[model samples]
Target chain A: MAGDKMLFVIVIGCGRLGANLASGMSAAGHSVVAVDSRQSAFDALDSRFSGYKIEGDATEFAVLQQAKTVSADLVVAVTDNDNVNLMAAQIAATVFKVPRVVARIEDPRKEDIYRALGIETICPATLAGRAFMASLESTPPKGAHNA
Target chain B: MNVLIVGGGKVVYFLCRAFISKGYSLTIVNRDSAECAWLARRLKAVIVHGDGTDLQILEECGAERCDAILAVTGHDQDNLAICQQARIRFNVQRTLAMVNDPDNEEVFRKLGVSAAFSTTRIITSLIEQRTGFEDIINLVPLEEGKVNLTEVVLRDISPVAGRALSDIALPENSLIAIVTRNGSPIIPRGGTVLAAGDRLVVITLPENMGRVIKLLTGGR
Candidate 1:
């Protein structure tokens, strides 16, 4: 892994998304570290990972210290709760002074909160509509006769 | 370019695998080390066992030089924070984030992210297509209402199943791009004929969906 110089990424959650992301990034030749509240979250990871793995509470300060985010190229928060993720971003910005930090916001209502916090956000609802529309475009209606 | 991933979801897995195939530099951040070991060994990407939302951990992971950052955790908040850190704090050139709520796409775009996607959206679209349309199995978007890619299966009820390409009048702005028989994809030509159980990939304008599907399958 050291042979190639690329971005270093850390994922906060070890749940479904966290595990999949870690495995995928590793496959892509990026250095990755995955963390989760529970050990079971790691079960989904592939056997031939391309990066290191750690199990711990991503919201805690001690866990962050162990992972060494101070010099990381990028940091990602994917925990289940929104508040914890926001706090994590605050810490990343205020304490560690990491150059980059990103957060996911599932609730469209809390978009303003995330934006006010100076963090980036992804809304799931809008994405759903877009995908639905896209699929509609490709899906021909039933019972239509075309040759 | 160096890429960073900040989630451990299914989409993240797919994204990571795609990057690996492209030979891009990659790094992953997660809370679990043991579970991620398999991926660690496969792509040889460095893994840090920690929270991505933490500033110190992100710094340690080297966010400054990353060319792109993607956040795809189960929680939308976490993905947002990772993208924020990568773009606002680290100054990463490109940032892609995942939204669990499809409604939040505008918010992501407004934040100046390079791109954003939601797994729920993709899955729902697939489900909707399968349930709402009997003849069409798959649909992919193209330009805004101008054209799209569709997958259709020919059944016994299809009127055009036994017809040659020249015999049927295709809907305006609609074209059959491919045909599959015996599970093998075949490029469609003028003389090609449609048969039962064959799958066709077609491109058509949005307004032509009703006409195209009706003419091809006879509207079962």
Candidate 2:
């Protein structure tokens, strides 16, 4: 949103959520490199969507390098496993020097640690509760946060 | 309009740029200073290093004075917390949240949020587009569906592909607004040729759906 050029993003994990975000971001005019160990992940991508794709474990440094994670301005770790996602975020932040890291932690309790570490984390359940409550106050859905 | 975003993740980046281009001020909040610097340097958005859910951070960032507040952190909980504080605690008038789950949209509306967008819902709609229905990929509901804006993808068999917009026998209450093709978006003109794979965004009433679909897909 900030640059004249598209933001360079690398998404770890090629599952349903990951592929959707990758394709959606690409549609939103961001440059993206999406990776996953399974070919099925790549298959779900829109045929017309143009971007980079690599097949390998996101946790492996070699795999990340191959996907050119170092050059990415932002890295999104949306893998199913919280530990792997945390590790991916660490790699993006500490190892690759990626400017920003956003990881999904399924467990809401882990958020405190994620925040303390300076990594942005999203906990689905708590966020949903706030949104549901906010909707009760307005006609159209309005955005509301808990903090 | 100036907007202060409560998070510095991908959605914030996308929305900030979009609103900024449409002439809106943008500020980003994140816990990481380096991330703040990087995001700020690129988007020219003001970056505040603090927790988005913190009342102090929102006030210090002057979020109350802004036109709109968008909380789109990876954590739905954080986004919800920030939006609520901005509303009830700080009294910020306009607020929006990203409802990570599609099933949560109705729930968000009940909470009084201005707008709630679910990535899951939008993605599913996109995936449903491949079904070969060229007339209207997704519809933007308006006034309880009294009038709606819809997108139509042009296919090879479309009867209106080569015809002028004015010549097409579109049902009353329907208007073609824009056409997006091959990644290039264009404002519609009367004589523009609709090519295969072109995505057309049209505004019309629900009653016109069948006619629109038939014309765009050359009815089976």
Candidate 3:
């Protein structure tokens, strides 16, 4: 951990996905700050996670400022709401000028908008569909005669 | 002028009617296909079915050629993104957004949205005005409520009622622009003497508004 450059990361939202990402990043020796509107969302993070937790709406500019997003090297917006994630990610990328910004959007159709803004997006629905299709393609169909 | 309106709701319907009546061309982009069809059937404007926050949808709606973009989505974040995209990407001259949260107004302004209106705050202020805070009635707030134009009514018991404009100490950066007595408007001057029932139109910073009100209303 001494030789590795610790990246300062701000993760907006503390849902299951957000919490897991925060904890993982923290475990990887990165400085992480997790933000959520509800204080209870922090419970999703494991006790071993030592990253900072901020209870506030990530869509707020002031809250982001309080989270020290201006100095953040990477910002991830994983809020359950697509609009909230998009707004937080855009603020990180465009307003705060963060070098790397990513948002989690449920609707895969919104990928174009995120792309146009030059923000990366992860859609669980699309990911799951592709994963299921890949698994199905790898396995032989049932009741098929041996070739 | 051509205008691109994003989202669908009562506000969109009313805006569509108003803009169409005024002979302005409108193109509405709504994610709800049913609402888009409803708007298409009722209004003469073109309807595009897609998420308004999507830049591709907005481009399909011809946002670049539009004179203005109105983002009135229920979600404040969506409205912010729509307005920002329209302004920065499409170069729309005017971008108006409906702010669901009053606290986000300054942030929207800082992000370069042409204007953001908080309906909740406006209604609250209207109710406050009706509650009759007699000393001063705020006429308008400009620059995110930093500067205000207010009407101050001078009562008979006011300390400055009989004082000349020069003698009465006004708050810093505050100016008495005009005076109305018995429905007659009078231009204010240094020698002008304030009287009971005189309505004064004052322009001042918001922080100094209270001091100006206290001085004019006899410290009430």
Candidate 4:
């Protein structure tokens, strides 16, 4: 998202997706704070990632409080653990009243309940499953069938 | 009543026993295979080996029509997910959760769990109550404060301190469910005697709280 206004963003879980988003957003000039349980997870962030890094369990309220979630303009939960992501996202949305909160939920069945709670969810399984289904359409590009 | 309990641990066995004795049909959902096997051998409830947070597992355990769902998992997040999914997807009216973090009790309530209990808060309250007051040690609210549970210690000053439960006329809608005598809990029966130094766990309505406390502690 590009706008003239800069936003304070908190990314929970410094996994591959979390680190990439934190680095990208930081490079884009937004204030970013990346949180992870393991300090080594920060190694994945790009050196150009000028965002602040805090190592702790993002699912914990204390960690989010230390990350200044109360003033966060946006919070993203991309942890590998579905429950952790749900907890972090819900706390951001309900407890801290963050404006925008999104979570990566691997279980597609849980997406509806997450949305019902006023939080957005990205389910990798559903997204990837759709992509696989689209690939089976068997429509080749121009001249690709000849190859 | 049919109740679905998630998580297979020591609490599961004891809860199973308690509910079974009460004549309620039960089902247990657990993630650990070995624990599931052990629970299957030890308990009389249907065991489903899967993550309780998953909607499919709850559906497999017949959560849709169960009278209540209890999430006693060790993790607060998992417990919240289980209860939330049970309520949202299955439309289970009564859902209780064991909150691992004492602070998340309010959070769980706000998130739509029917009731949330925290052992840490209870134990902390007991310890603090021992140091804080002579009687009426701790108070906990449930069902959005529609009901209240209080821990009252019977002292020499108490009016009903030396009487049996059958002899005392307790306030309407209030009951002394458990009596903790010298650190052990005894479910108060008709013949159970209440003595000084016994801790009473009383469940009552919000309106009668003060009167119940006064009656128990003779503090009016």
Best by DockQ: 4
**After best superposition, candidate 4 residue A126: deviation in angstroms?**
2.6
Stretches of candidate 4 exceeding 4 Å from the true structure? A141-147, B131-137, B146-220
Shares of reference contacts reproduced by the candidates, in order, are 0.09, 0.00, 0.37, 0.40
Q: TM-score of the candidate numbered 3?
A: 0.71
DockQ of 1: 0.05
* Residues A35-76, model 3: lDDT tens digits: 999999999998657999999988767899999999999999
DockQ value of candidate 4: 0.45
lDDT per residue for candidate 1 within B1-220, as digits (tens), equals 8998887745556778899888988888887776477567665677777888766677888999898887777766577667876776678888888776664454455545666676666797788655645668546555422467878888898988888998888867989999989979999787898999888888888788778888878873
Residue B201 shift from truth in candidate 3, angstroms = 3.9
Residue B173 Cα positional deviation in candidate 1, in Å, after optimal superposition: 5.2
Cα lDDT of candidate 2 equals 0.75
lDDT: worst 10-residue window of model 4 chain A = A136-145
The deviation in Å at residue A106 for candidate 2 is 20
Off by over 4 Å in 2: A1-147, B14-23, B130-136, B142-147, B151-220
Task: Return the lDDT, model 3, position B34.
Answer: 92
TM-score of each candidate? 0.46, 0.43, 0.71, 0.77
How high is the lDDT of residue A113 in model 1? 54
TM-score of each candidate's B chain against the true B chain: 0.62, 0.64, 0.79, 0.67
- Tell me the interface RMSD of every candidate, in Å: 12.2, 13.9, 3.2, 1.3
Runs of candidate 3 with Cα error greater than 4 angstroms are A1-9, A25-33, A37-43, A50-56, A60-75, A80-82, A89-147, B134-139, B143-147, B151-159, B165-192, B195-200, B205-220
Alpha carbon deviation, residue B130, candidate 3 (Å): 1.2
